[model samples]
Target: ARKNGRVGIVTLAKRPWLTESARIFLPGLDLEKLLDELQIPVFYAFEHVSRRVASFGTPNSYVAAKRNAMSECLAQLFGEAKQCSSAMSIGDSEIELLAIQELMSELAMSRFSTPLESPLQFCKTVLLRENPSLVQLQRQIESLANSLGSLVDHPGDLSLELGTGRRLRLRNHLGPNLR
Candidate 1:
């Protein structure tokens, strides 16, 4: 209701109805104390099997995400329900993420090496630069080049779409002669 430019606001009074299994503690949540600690407008939360995870959000999306995340966290923690693999967690969540492999293997009805199939490899900037051997560097460079080429092609026919809509002209940002 305030003139803040945001999709929505989740007030503390109406926040509890977001999830089924997650319990929120309001009296325990000292808003002023938290703001003093974090130095940010952190106000909302989702939950795990135990603990409160608080942060700010865009009401509807936040509440929806909190519901989904709490559900998955409860599932994973209790080993009863399924974890939402794609759910991203904030530092405030106080929840530990079991590797995707663990969740996939546990939920699989048939025996298949899903984890082995999708091994996550992170090449940090420093690691990809000053940290590898010559052969490793070359391999990484080739991989990077391939990724660049994939993005170089147009995502959609931009010319075809704009041609029929109206007369179009390019701005002279590329230098007056080029434009």
Candidate 2:
């Protein structure tokens, strides 16, 4: 595998499932020297690869940014490489990273009703707080409340004024003195 220029090598030191031959072969392998001979770059990054998918910006902004940048860089590197296999390499622990990522993504899809738009939600929640246009809405509601309050006078003279800008005359239902 090391002799092939197109084969990307990822060395994992502690794999319990390694076959007897693989166990023997791993100790003899000089990863740095082999990669140098092949002129391939090795990126020792498990933080991003093994990161839990369900975390919608839970860790922090910096870690999320770093993870995004790392993934983007890897993707770009792989896309620009001469061959797909020659572009990237990972450590032993990263062997299960792809599966974990896929499973977590599926879980997130099933678990959440909406896609977590953390930054947008944060800004919107901060700006709007409870109401989107509290002052304007409040003024309108207060005006309506006042109109309703005015209409709820004596039972003998029922006068209900509805709507704005235009006023419609409503005839009184009862006489002047109901006593």
Candidate 3:
């Protein structure tokens, strides 16, 4: 299909037997690496299928789930014009390009109805702010551990003073060997 200038998409089930089959057929070949080299995108049917559709026991429901998963994969493929172009030749048809743009816009709006901050962005915002108490506590723990010296064989200095004026010490009542 690729040699004939047609895009080939593969949909696979999420199962261990696929790997076993690949091992038997190809013998030491990296299936994923081969797929990458061929520029073939592989979509796992179960990954894209919604939980609700997947939960249904009917054969029709199973078909619907597979269809839904395929729809998502196709949408993702066609959603970006550059990606679509790289995958296969869409030519310079203005109408097709305009349609793709419209589809992408629709997909974006449908997927994200409400504005949301990504977890990474939220984490960056949180990390940028300084927390003095946490820093102090961390420093105190480090200091305490340092004061204790090598805790492997023998116990060194057993007492330490924290920055908060609290005294921390290993109990002497436990005797010399403190495992």
lDDT winner, 2 or 3: 3
The prediction achieving the highest TM-score against the true structure is: 3
User: Which ranges of candidate 2 are over 4 A from the true structure?
Assistant: 2-5, 10-30, 47-97, 100-179
Model 2 agreement with the true structure over 1-179: per-residue lDDT tens digits: 32322333222212232333344767877655655677654332333444453244433432333333334443444553211211111212222233223322333334345445211110000011123265755654565455433333222222222222334333321112211
For model 1, residues 1-179, the per-residue Cα lDDT tens digits are 11211111122224434331133535456555543454323223343212332344444434444444444543534354342222221121112122222333243322234534432211101013334566865665675444433322323111111112233222211112211
lDDT of 2 at 126: 5
Encode model 3's per-residue lDDT on 1-179: one tens digit a residue. Answer: 34433243423356555556788977989877776787756555556566776666555554444444444555555664223221211211222222223333333334444323111000000011123477875775575446332322233212223563544444222123211
Candidate order by lDDT, decreasing, is 3, 2, 1
**Cα miss at 40, model 3 (Å)?**
1.1
Model 2 steric clash pairs = 12-92
How high is each candidate's TM-score?
Answer: 0.19, 0.23, 0.38
Off by over 4 Å in 1: 1-85, 96-111, 119-179
Clashing pairs in 1: 44-55
Model 1: lDDT equals 0.30
Root-mean-square deviation of each candidate, in angstroms?
20.8, 30.0, 26.0
